[model samples]
Target: MAAVSATVILLIGVGVPVSIVAPVPQARAEVAQEQQRATDPAAIRLPSFGSSAVGVVGMPGVLAKRGPQAPRQMASITKVITMLVVLEKRPLAAGEDGPTITLGQRDVGYLDQVIAANGSWQPVQAGWRVSQRAAIETTMIPSANNYAETLAVWAYGSVPAYLDAARAFLKANGLDDTTVVDTNGLSSGDRSTPTDLVDLGRIALANPVLAATVRMATADEPNVGALENTNQLLGTDGIDGLKTGTYDTGANLLFSATRRVGDRTVRIVGVVLGARDHPTLDARVPAVVDSVVAGYHDLALAKPGQVFATYETRWGGVGRAVAAKAVSRVVWSRARVVRKASVDPITGGRKGERVGEVTYSVDGSTVVVPLVLDRDVLAAPVWWRLTHPLR
Candidate 1:
């Protein structure tokens, strides 16, 4: 009886720990996934002739190009540069009239010069007291060559000084391909590439005063009476304003527009250099704007209950790791989207248990979605555990 009792005691002690504390089989995850749908680039329509480029404001590089990247005559678009430079010296807050600038003999001389050259001008006379905003409006709205020269001289002391400042501004802004010969773009030497002008457009839009002044279709100036904007494309096709220029050889336009894409507000900047005429350039701009707007889409990243990984056990238990809810992202031009999944081994758990997670990234933004089990994974039967020792 003593020998039998000793053997039974040893067996009971060993079996109890084996059944209670022994390890269960780990769940094996198989990473099987279906390919995401592919997207194509939009057919962006560009001007048939001349040079053109378009880009989103915050994005890097141009989205579309139709002509050579080499510099071309940028006509009155030079005023945009002039405005940028002058504002650097004489900055103005939005809605502030700034200091009063009294037109003098030099300003009148500027007006006479533009009239003689057959360039754009608004009437200005010596001794006419004008607010700084009015001068800017006159310069930009009517493409007045005289006010441009006047603003340049006023801000930096003379056109030559303004030229020096302009060069500095260009260098600082990375517009290496752009050259400004005079305060106004009247000189054919005023040259820039479609690419550089697009970047310039971004710079102009960033300035609050220039942004507001350029969009005005008409402004009542103290000296010039009611001045009309040279950019007729304003208030059309969502185009607000930038600048316009034309010379004997060709016309050019640096334009900006506000567009909506999937609940996101987008600013688009573009340039058309060497267009045959203003009408032709204006006609092609809408198509370019539309193409850019169409490039953004809401991409579906994951669907509710979509399986990302399959969980299986040696004990004949099976489960699935799935997305808990739908997920999506707003992306531009089919930007490359990438995903990664992380799942943990499991012995058994109830349905809807959080297993792990999946991370998605696109256009420098990230999104995380939780992964859950599709069904409960039952533990190995007690009889099986008792008969088969844990390895």
Candidate 2:
């Protein structure tokens, strides 16, 4: 009877081993699924575009687009590129004197035609040479066609040369579908999509000088009388001067605005094309700007030190465990989906110990990557160590 009793006890102890199980909470699983869905780019329904348009509200990659791939005549917005190319290749120092620009016969001819058409002009008289500074200011503030042509000639020695340089600049900046037939957006042939124009605006905003000039509501030049920016958005709280383009075929505008939301500074770039007229543009651009502002939010899907799971260490003594935090906080569009994640332990882990890991499915296959301990794990407490030292 004693032997049978001992056998039964042994069987029972062997049948049920002492173990620790940490199950993920229902809320956590839901959060993970939500995050996964948000990170998947295919799930998002980005705005559609007729020719290519892109709008970036703030960081965290909240990119909205309409006709983001379609090409359209950019008009004066092309001057954004003209200004960028000049700044990149031949930068002028702040407070430095302007460079002398000799007015050539071709420049004079172009100026005459622009003035005759009553197009935006800098009052550039024939044989009246102007400083490079004057030409740039005129081009930017009033969207002067002659000023752009003059600057193009000064920079590249001729209109054709300037166009080649502009084309090269566009190609280098991933504006493959864009083309520039002229430095000034006067020609309808010089076309780009709203997507490309947004990119150009971002590039221009990076330059302190260019950004400052664009923000100015009015500027004076030797050749051109006081010029006011055609951009109506300028000086309208949160609206900075970008550029406006108009022609018989289409009217377009590219605007970059900055506003403080809580402790963060949010920058919004808006592009509108094919508006019927100035009034239409005025009505539409502000709405787009407001949309971007309303959509902007601090993506709080992930938090610092938030633990996704807790796992026991295989090699460590009893009561030893590890906690894993979500990877970097991700802020992406709604449709983006996160297929998988990885964990990197910061401290206290033994070799082969389950410090952390990520389990996810991708394309119908489960993939796992182990997160090893970043720091060495000390032995268990002295009291526990005495009884549970490395077996």
Top candidate when judged by TM-score against the true structure: 1
Q: What TM-score number comes out for model 1? A: 0.87
Q: Model 2, clash count? A: 24
Q: Candidate 2 overall Cα lDDT vs. reference?
A: 0.63
> Pick by lDDT: which candidate is best?
1
Q: Model 1 RMSD to the real structure?
A: 3.1
The residue-by-residue lDDT of candidate 1 on 127-167, one tens digit each, is 99988888888889988899999989988898899999999
Residue pairs clashing in model 1 are: 76-245
**Clash counts for the predictions, in order:** 1, 24
Candidate 2 residue lDDT tens string, 37-83: 44323232322323324455434222666644467788888888898
How does residue 329 of candidate 1 score in lDDT?
A: 71
Candidate 1, superposed: residue stretches over 4 Å from native:
34-38, 313-318, 324-326, 330-338, 348-354, 359-370, 374-391
